[model samples]
Target: MTMKWKGWALATGALAFSATAMAAPPSAEMISFACAGCHGTNGGSAGLTMPSLASQSKTAIVDAMKKFKSGERPSTVMGRLAKGYTDADFDAMATFFSKQKFHPTTQAVNAAKVKKGEALQEANCSRCHLEDGKEGKDDTPVMASQWLPYLQMQMDLYQSGARKMPEKMAEKVKPLSKEDLDALLHFYASVK
Candidate 1:
């Protein structure tokens, strides 16, 4: 090779190496990357039951991970999955997910169910989750447009004591029936 070409190649190689070195290692990123398989790319899930993590509040994600790890929340896999992550990993994953845009899913809903849910929400749920279910506070989560099954399961957990709940929240859930939950789920599923 010409001397000039060799020098150019060497500089390019050095630049590439430095770029790679400056970036965090794959394992550090894997802590968040591991969720893509199930949560979908950037946490926009196509699964009917899988909850979307994209655009979720970072505080909500971190809190949930801590809850799952501490045995304060019930889950089929999240509890076990959370056990593998450290606080830093959880925080990084939360930040990664919170940056993504949240696109609402198209799920069928009944008018009657939505109406009932709207009532329930206006009365109790909206105080914390807001009318659109995005969030009422910084740490609160966006419940709007989440998968119905996942929302229902969480409600079930909260109601059954499988998940810890404050006394005030518990009181509100105490009066809920199956139909009530279904209505609420349908309503939130339909929101943007």
Candidate 2:
């Protein structure tokens, strides 16, 4: 090849390489790591209130992220975080979390709490959350495996009207006294 033609070919090849690199999507590990700052590595959070995302259903993750992005769901940090991602990004993150195994942790294991909470859950929250609090195999998120502090915080948000909740969920939450909420959190955490 002529020197001039060779130079042009090299330039073209370089450009193609760069473009190819740019076109590739971020690995699921990389994407999940970005969330690990708060969500913990592999979605197993050690924080008192952060929820574990590992092994959660994809639909649940996608829906929550979409709600945060659209401002339909009330959140402090999540809305801003969700706004930064596209639907496709959310899907990828959800899929990543869904594949990882959930590592459940707990602090309080009062039998009384578990017993009372079970009764309360059966009466009011069983429809969507299911009897196991795993949220069934549906679009709804899991509860039994969530952090107790986080669960309590979310419950408080609903009860105090600080955060918006689904109408049906809010209605069920309305009847829960402070004690009931505590017991419920305890029960769920123990099962996890």
Quality of model 2 by C-alpha lDDT: 0.80
- The worst-scoring run of ten residues by lDDT in candidate 1 lies at 20-29
- For residues 50-146, could you state the per-residue lDDT of candidate 2 as single tens digits? 8888878899899889888888777889999998888888989999998887667857578998899898888888888875676435676778768
lDDT (Cα atoms) of all candidates against the true structure = 0.80, 0.80
Pairs that collide, model 1: none
Per-model TM-score, in order, reads: 0.81, 0.80
Error of 2 at 126 (Å): 2.3
Residue 74 in model 2: lDDT: 77
Model 1: what TM-score?
A: 0.81
Candidate 2: worst-modelled 10 consecutive residues by lDDT:
15-24
